[model samples]
Every structure is written in C-alpha cells, then in structure tokens.
Target: MPSSINPGATLVLTGVTHILVGLTHPRLGPPLLSMVRSGLFDSITGISLDPTSSGAPQYDRMAAWWFELAGAAMILLGISIRENINVAGYVPRGVAWGTLGVGVIGALVQPLSGCWTLIAQGIWMVGWFGKTKME
Candidate 1:
C-alpha cells in the first residue's frame, strides 16, 4: 500500500513487445503469415509438436509457438487486471505479491528477459511512488 501503480499499461506494453518479437522471428514469421493468409480456415486439429524433437526447425516452431501464446496470455491478463482495477480501485495484494515472486524467480533464471518488467509492475503495485486513479 505504498503508492503509484499502473500495472495495466506495463503488462500491456510487455505483451505487445513479446507479440512483436514472435511476429518478427525469422524462422516463424513466414509460416505465421502463411497461416494468417489462409485465415486459419484449415483444420489445425490433432497437431502435436514433439518436444523431444531435436531438429532445428522443430525447435524453432516450438519456441515461436510458446512465445506467441505467452504474449497472448499476457495481453489477456493485462486487460483483465485493468478491468478489475477499474471496478475495484485497487489490485489485490496477492496478485501483486505473486507477480513479484514470479519476477524474482524468472529473473534469477534469465536475467536478460522481460521478468524485469514484471518486477517493476510488482514493485509499483505493492508500493513505489503514489497511488494514481485509473484513467
């Protein structure tokens, strides 16, 4: 309960960045565009990616898929949190703390990743500057 926090914007921006990364990925971008062009009209059922596959192409697809999915999830989470804050006037402490813990653990494992953003969001949520009203 310290002060200023704008978690929504942070999460959204991070998500957008991740999505862009996935879209621009050299190996995955072409296939992604092809899928989009096809309108995903074709059935994509029963498609299983073998995690054990060691081929460079298989790994690239896996990485790209996970990246895009995570980005989408972040966007969804941000929108949901924003809506909740709009209605409740505050983010739950559990959410803030949870994000902080996640950030810390993720950053520990991958110091160069976006976990830093999560860390900042958590810090802001818990207490950083001043509490601002959601616009």
Candidate 2:
C-alpha cells in the first residue's frame, strides 16, 4: 500500500535522521569522545563526579549506551512515520515515552551527552505530535 504521509512530516523525519547520523558516526564520534575523556564537557555542564583510576564512571555505563541507542531508534521511528504510518502503529506511544524517560535519566547522569539525546527525542516527539493518520 502507498504510504499515508505528509510532506512536512517527511521533512522532519529526514532532518532528524541526518542529525542522528551525524552525531553517531565516526566523524563526530572522536570529538565527542574526546570531550568525555578530557572532562571539559562535564566541567562546563557540571555533572561529573570523580572517576576511579580506571577512568570510567563509578556507575553503570548501560544508561549512557541506552540513551545513544534511543537516539538511533528515534531516527528510525521518524523514518517509519514518514514511509508508513502503519509502521508508526507498530512503534507504540510507549517508545516516545521511553525515549523521553531515557533522555531524562541520561540528563541526570550525564548532562551534556544526555542533552543532545533529549533534543533528538524532543524533536521526534514533536514530529509524532504533528503526524496525522489517514484512512
């Protein structure tokens, strides 16, 4: 079946995908990793505690990884909404809520990194809100 979609929604989805791809890919990855390593970002954001000698967070890394994955998922979710509203139905409202939840958790844990994810999820949430179902 032809996708029941809107042009503006498609633009939003494509824009979000481009942003997520840029953030996650290798070109931007090292700079981001360097920021995390150097503590400059944390210093500016004021969210980090002292790390042990191993140079890792005292807490679990899973939440940070989850936030990144959620950002990627939001890109996919936007694509699905653009290409197929039926696929949108498969995603469930909970995914958006879950994304927002992760964003909040990530922000609390690592403000700088988390804020980017939060913005992505927030954009996706806006796209979702703007979408309309066509019979």
Candidate 3:
C-alpha cells in the first residue's frame, strides 16, 4: 500500500543528474564565467550570430548557459525539498502543486525533457496513495 518513491531523494538525484549533464558540455566554461562576471545582465543580449563565423558558436554558448543554470536550480530545489521534509516531516502541498505547475509548463514547452519526472514526483508528493496530509 505504501509508495516506493521517496520524493526528497528523487529530487536530489534529479538535481545531481542535471549538474552532471551540464558538465558534459565541452565549452560551457567561458559562457558561464562571462555570465557570472557581468552579473548576468550581459546575457540579456541573448545569442547573436556572427556573420563572419560559421557553425553554432552563439547557439552553443546560450545552450550551455541555460543548461548549467537549470542544473544549479534543480540542485537548489532538491535541497529545499529535503530541508522541508526534514523539518516538516512532509513536503508541503503548496510545494507539490508548484512543482506540478512547473512540470506541466516545462513538459508543454519541451515535451522531450525530463519534466515528466517532475510531474510524477509532484503527483507522488500530493499523496495520491493516501500518504501525505494533503493540507
């Protein structure tokens, strides 16, 4: 009758996976460093293609920046979930709903992404199995 899923652990694992995936990009360093150095305001210009250059240099930079940023964010989310669970003995319903909302949006925007896992995690945390308080 009990669910095998541990939402907190799952979130943490997801975060770790995200970070690892981001690290796999060969040229993520310069772009990420540039964003950091400029307080990310410089990134507002977005990706601009150089007519003189070939290939997807600009696109790759932007992609790496976003991938790394998302990975860091996911890690933070996992930490928040774990801490909340530790202190409250359960993930708040609001957090579950929020995750579900984000998951839905992400899934809609990028159907091939791992947002479905977030959706599943949200549903599990929402106490469909009658585990959480749902308050």
Top candidate when judged by lDDT against the true structure:
3
Per-candidate TM-score against the hidden true structure: 0.69, 0.37, 0.65
Model 1, C-alpha of 65: deviation from truth (Å): 0.8
Model 3: per-residue Cα lDDT over 1-135, one tens digit each: 222246877887887887676666457766666666778765535345666644444565587767867877777877777666655557777888888888999999999988998898888768633344333
lDDT of 1 by residue, 1-135 (tens): 322335765787789998998899787676667666657564133344866644344454455667788888878877766665666656677877887888899999999988888898888767622345445
Pick by lDDT: 1 or 2, better one: 1
Q: Which ten residues in a row have the lowest lDDT in candidate 3?
A: 126-135
Superior by TM-score: candidate 1 or candidate 3: 1
Supply the TM-score for candidate 3: 0.65
Question: For candidate 2, lDDT tens digit of each residue in 1-135?
Answer: 435444225435544654565457665554555557767434223234544333444222333334455555656665654555554433346655665676677678888653554546545654565445544
Cα lDDT computed for each candidate against the true fold: 0.70, 0.51, 0.71
TM-score of 2: 0.37
Q: Per-candidate RMSD vs. true structure?
A: 5.3, 9.3, 6.6
lDDT of 2: 0.51
Report the Cα lDDT for residue 126, model 1.
75
